[model samples]
Target chain A: MQGDERGAVMKPLRRPRALPGTATPRPRHRADRRPRSTLRTILALAAGGVVATGVALLASGGTYALWSDTADLAPATITAGSSTLTVAGVAEHAVEELDLTLLAPGRSVTTPRPVAVANTGTTPLAVTVSTIAIPDGNAQLAEFLRFETAVDTGGGETCDLAPFAVAALTGESASQPPVTILPGEEAQLCLRIGLTADAPASVQATSAVFSMIVTGDQVRVP
Target chain B: MIKRMSGTLALVLVLVLSGAGIGHAYWSAHGELTGRVAVGTLSMTQTGVDGLAAAFTTDVTEVTAPVVVTNDGTVSAPFALSFTGAPAAAEGTGQSSGDLGAATLVSVWPAADAASCASVPAGDAPDGSTSSTGWNAIPPLLGTLEPGGSAVHCVRAVIDPARAAPGDTVVVTSSLTSGIGSWSSTSTADFGQSFSDDAIVSPHSF
Candidate 1:
């Protein structure tokens, strides 16, 4: 009975229907409709890897010139003033030169003070200087007194009174600059003395003994 | 794929850390304790004299300081010497000539004036400033001067005896600089040479 009914229903269905130009529809595919797990995983992983690579490149790309600068502040300065002399500050100016002695005697000759002493002190002080030193390890008052005097426009004079052959500064005196401060001072009442000239041809034998005695208590240099 | 990705990420991180480490190291570097005059003979002779002294000039004329710059360091360094009135000599040419050079050369200045510098210290770093104790007028520089290399600089400065005193000193300074280090040398000469009223260019026939 099933075959007889199927035969009767297929009689019209078996007949060829002709249209103008349309082709017959192919059979539908079940496999094409299914989801692909492997492909999905691969694409997700590829996208993640690309993102990671991009992040890495940004991290290492450019260089920034990171630097720091500082102002080497000029050291505090102290100058010599009038009757009132206050020890304001101190500074050091140093220069060093080296020479090759291949042809002659290769000696590192240092001409510490080639000229007269540089004007290291700040304030203008009218100082009448005398030479006092300890010669041969003994305190003595030398006879020769050399005074380098320059007339000041404001009645202020500076002199580096050196007794030609004295070596050390041992004792304190009223005529010379003071070596020690009384109290309430940061540094001693010292004068700014430097080697004025270039390196000397021959180093002088005599050591320098400057006995600085500040007369006025309130002298401050700019 | 996961393994490859992990490897690449690890490599990238390592590179970044390495670069930072280098920069930090260089920034934190410090200097190691390494490191390290004459005058006269200035005169000129000319025909005819001014009415007073003699048929020829008889006054202190010029101050010439002949200097030899030597490099004593173990490493090679480059150097450049600058002056106020003259353009510096080109690299390897130890002398400057003519007015352009003379403009950069220091002429009339006090011995203690900061404008007269002679030799630049040896170094590769840029000075950008002058040394406090060095020759004063011109700013200082440390280009590069090789170690053990020596350069000579001469200043032919004429002074008028009528105006310039005999005992006065004319100072010239220069610098020799190398990698990160510099050396300054100065020459100061007393004024006592033949005088010519007019400015004469001496023939540096070397």
Candidate 2:
């Protein structure tokens, strides 16, 4: 190319080559001068990620519970029937109450005031009365006694204090009454206890023994 | 460059370890039910008395309440007896400790009168009384009560006097088993006179 004082005469300059693994340098842009904002954003994101992770861990810590497999147990014990038995098992209805109590002495009490038996059974039971067995020595009161069963649909049932063989307290005294119970349910029974006149002063007694035949099938135990 | 890479790797390692620790803690608390023990099953018996001879009678002179416990789950759950509504004058001791296969009875009633009865509590009771001779310290094992079966233990109740007069009756309350957070209803045993027995009383002369 011929060079003149004012005439066009220009040559291109060569750029340097990059070394191994080095990226070729380019012209600096406005973004390169202000990279602090992007670095700050990355650090903030890391911190937020850690905070979120900690919160998630806290929310799920040791949390557990059960849903099904709940079981209900029902026990039935018959005292003054043809057969004295107890039945206990798991059932569907929720058991409300099972209670037992003794009747006190009173003269006006007719037929050994009907023992107040409560029925907490989930389902109503057709309660019947039958003589189980007579006390070991009282073969005399056997003739004047008869038994009957009355169902109290709302709460419980009671045993008949009649003069039939199945009666619970036909010839019994008022002091201690007979026990009336709800089969397959929990209720109280009142028995007429005849404290013998020829008893010891301080007998440390345990439980009473009554030998009666069981006729109805209401006793259960699981 | 090396410093930047090392920092990132350390942070990742810490995060992974933290995650694992949280997972472990969670697993430890909410693990599955791993055990069950058959506590016991009770049988009922009624006997007849021939005579009414005493004022204060003891019905349960001997008792044998039995129970069975089994390990049904993968983990072990300890067992215990929780008593509710114990009578002040009641006398009786219960087995305090047991294992998967064995159980022992503890005595309670007829302890030198009502004062001695205080020494025996109904459920776990208090810890001040004399320790039972056998199976006293083992608080039911921490084991699974087999899913289907049970670990059995027997408890006995004995009555001192054979029979009581017409005016007296005895009330005994008890329960033989319990679960970790649930409760079984209290079982009751009663002894008293019936209608026919009342005839034994001498009639009032008119």
- DockQ, every prediction: 0.02, 0.01
Model 2 lDDT tens row, B91-201: 244322112111123332212222333334344323332223223332332223323434433332222232323222222223334233221222223222111133233
Which candidate tops lDDT? Answer: 1
Question: Where in model 1 is the C-alpha error above 4 Å?
Answer: A1-222, B1-58, B80-143, B165-167, B170-206
TM-score of chain B of each: 0.29, 0.26
Candidate 1 lDDT over residue span A1-222, tens digit each: 698898888766553665768786655687765467666666756766676556555666743459866788889988633222222221211223311211011111222222121122333333322223323331211122121212112212222332222122233333444222222322211122222233231221222232222232323334
A1-222 in candidate 2: lDDT tens per residue? 456633534545567688989987977897667578667667766765675566545544632356556667798786632322221121111112110121111101122333333333432222332233444334333232222323232332333433322235433322222233444453223222232222221211112223222122233433
The alpha-carbon deviation from the true structure for residue A178 of candidate 1, after best TM-score superposition, in angstroms, is 72
Leading candidate by TM-score: 1
* TM-scores of all predicted structures: 0.18, 0.17
lDDT of 1 at A52: 54
- Superposed by TM-score, candidate 2 places the C-alpha of residue B141 at a distance from the truth, in angstroms, of 9.9
- Candidate 1 achieves a global lDDT of 0.31
